[model samples]
Target: MLTALKEETYKFCHEKIALLGLLVLLVTTLYSTLTKTINKSTLIFAFGAIEWIPVIIIAVGAAFFEMEYDNKTIVMLLYKNSSKLKIYLAKFLVVFCYSIALALGAILLTFLLSLLTVPGQYHWLAYYQGHTILTNLLLNLFGAVIYCFFIVGLSFMLIMLVKANTVVICIGLVLAYFGASFSTALMHTFPTAVGILKWNPLNMIFISQQLTRGSFALKSNLTNFQLIIATVVYGIIFGLLGYYLFKRRRV
Candidate 1:
């Protein structure tokens, strides 16, 4: 498994999808901080705008496997005695780790930009006087990464089911674009179902909103703990489904 992971990581690095994702985060972070008067708190929120980037990149990375299938190269990998689970896991880890790295890179770049642009205008410890800038950044980073994991899991399931990059990309973008609104509408229209709706995987896509916006988080009717649980449960479910399908798929 470690060897498989290393090889996949090497492939990911060679393909440069992770590099591209990092570059996107860099550009978006610069555009966000330079174009707007954003402080540390707001800077954290701004980077969340491009959180879908990891999903997009991960989807693209998953397509490499689809290409393997199309080219009949995956059979070679499968024939090497590596369990299908390990192969699936290697790809998933590549995407998942990349997602987390992208989020961290955004946080770092946004902070540096904030330092250069905002200077002494805003204190890093402003979010909570008790918490330092680094602490708050970690919290926001955690929030962003939780959603990234959820999206990666969703991508895994989609890649397995569709086996096409374009469809996964389209569906991912659509969900990222409107998933929050749809959930909000559902919650408002059927207030009684809010409890159940909060657990929906799509509902966790914009979890950063809930993390940053106190009022909105309250309105979400889901405590941060519940949201975390929902994200983890959804990730696990999608990962299992993807692996199950991949194990039985004709390569």
Candidate 2:
């Protein structure tokens, strides 16, 4: 497992897209910070830079698998690492680490931007959305991490099923952008079944909002704990399905 992990990490580090993704995150965050007028630094600090995270996660995850197939290196990988489970897990771990790194990078960049642009406008201890600014930021980062897992799992499954990176990315982007709204529409459209529908994976996308907005629970019909659990469960399910397909696929 450790050897597989090291090999996966080495491959990811050598991917040009990996570095490009990081650069894009920093540049977008910087642009967003500079363009927005300073009102509440806490809001800017927490969300200003993370708007593109999901998009990047989807693209990166899909591209990782796509590259292997495109380069016809998956057969070599399978031959080298006798354990399919280790290869799948190592790839997932690398992507998860990339997601966390992106989240941390966004947070760090946003923090520095906030300090530089409006040093005294907000206090870290100041309460916002029923928690201190620092707490909200931490929770937001946590929510982002959870969402990353969900996306990676779903992306892997889609890639295995469709064998197309573009399709996976498109579906992921649509879900990332419209999933919450779609859930809301579902709740209203089928008011009688909300109790069941509210637990759907689409609804889990609102985990970030529920974490930061005190009133979001009422709107999402799910507590933060429930959303977190549901999201992780869905991630695991998708990941397992993807692995099953991968194991059965002809190399």
Candidate 3:
């Protein structure tokens, strides 16, 4: 397992396209941050741009698996004693770790840049009163990480099933962004199915937004606890399904 993980990580790290994606994330984040006010709220908003990070990582994950199949490398790995489960999980873990690291790096960079560029505008105290800045920021970051896992894991599951990088990435992004909005609107229209609709994985994508800002919940009936639980359940389901499918794949 350890050897498989190291091999997966090394492949991801060495990919020029993957490195370019990270560079794009950093550049775009910096540009977006500088355009807005440099404060606690703005810092969070800047990192919110990281919603696209998972999409790039999803492509990476799909490519990681597809390349092996294309080159018939899976045969070599099996002969060298690597189990299907180990390779599958190693790819998943690498993609998952990249998603989390990209999020953290973007958030931290935004905070530091905000401090350096506009120290006078740093309003951590006013933005989140009664709670220390660190506490509020940490809680918010935790929620963001949870959402990241949902998207990354869901993408992993889809890629495994579809085995097409572009199709999976496109479908995943649409679901991640528009799925919740449309579902919430429909739930409002029907009003009776809110209970079941709220549990949809796509609808739970905005869990972090609802967590950090009370105003974000004005349109929805879901509580933070419900969203958190739904996110966890969906993440686990996606992960398990991916593992099952990979284990059963012919190649």
Candidate 4:
């Protein structure tokens, strides 16, 4: 496992697409933060810079999985690792870590931009939405961590099953942006199955919203804790299923 993880990390670091994706994420973060006219620094701090996180995650995740198949490297990886599960997990872990790194980068850049662009505008201790700016930021980041796991797992599973990077990326982007909205619409349209539909993976995307503002629970019909649990559960399910498919796939 350790060997597989090291190789995976090294490969990811050397990938041009990974570096380009990081650059794009940083640029978009800056653009999103600077373009917002709202003076609410806390809101800008938590959300503005992270607006492109899901898109980047989807793109990078698709590329990571597809690259192995495209380059015919999976045969070598399978021969070297002996354990398909280890290889799959190592790749997933590398992508998951990349997602966390993106989040941290966004947070750091948002803070620095806030300082340089609007000096004294942000108050870490100042309350916003019933919590301090710093508190809200942390909560949002925590939610983002869970979201990353869910999305990355979903991405890996989709790529393994579809074997098409473009299609996987498109599906992922749509879900990242509209999954919550679609889930809401479903619940409304089929009001009788709200209980089961509320637990759907799509609805779990609202964990961040509910965590940042308790009022969002009314819309999600779930508490922050419930959302967190559901998201984690779905993430694990996808990861296991992806591994199963990867193990059974023809080399």
How does residue 88 of candidate 3 score in lDDT? 72
| lDDT of residue 199 for candidate 2 | 88
Give model 1's TM-score versus the native structure: 0.88
lDDT of 4: 0.80
Candidate 3: list runs displaced more than 4 Å.
Answer: 34-40, 129-136, 218-220
The TM-score, computed over Cα atoms with residue i paired to residue i, of candidate 3 is 0.85
- Predicted candidate 2 versus true structure: per-residue lDDT over 141-160, tens digit per residue: 78878888988888888888
lDDT of 1 by residue, 1-251 (tens): 99899988887788755666666677767676656667555665644544555455556656756766877878888888468888888887887787777766766676677677777877666655346665656666677677667766777778788888888888877777787788778888998887787677667765665564556665567877777778878878888988888888877
Pull out the clashing pairs in model 2: none
How do the predictions measure up, each by TM-score? 0.88, 0.94, 0.85, 0.94
Query: Is candidate 2 or 3 superior in lDDT?
Result: 2
Task: Please give the distance, in angstroms, between residue 139's alpha carbon in candidate 4 and its true position after superposition.
Answer: 1.1
Residue pairs in steric clash, candidate 4?
none
- Model 2 is weakest, by summed lDDT over 10 consecutive residues, at 41-50
Query: Over the stretch 1-251, how does candidate 4's per-residue lDDT look in tens digits?
Result: 89999999999999997898779877876666667663554453454544467667877887898899899998898887788888888888999899888878877876776777678876778888888887787777778778888888888888889989899878877887798889889999999998888898888777765787887787688888899988988889999988888888787
**Error at 134, model 4, angstroms:** 1.3
RMSD versus native structure for model 2? 1.6
> What is every candidate's alpha-carbon RMSD to the true fold?
2.4, 1.6, 2.6, 1.6
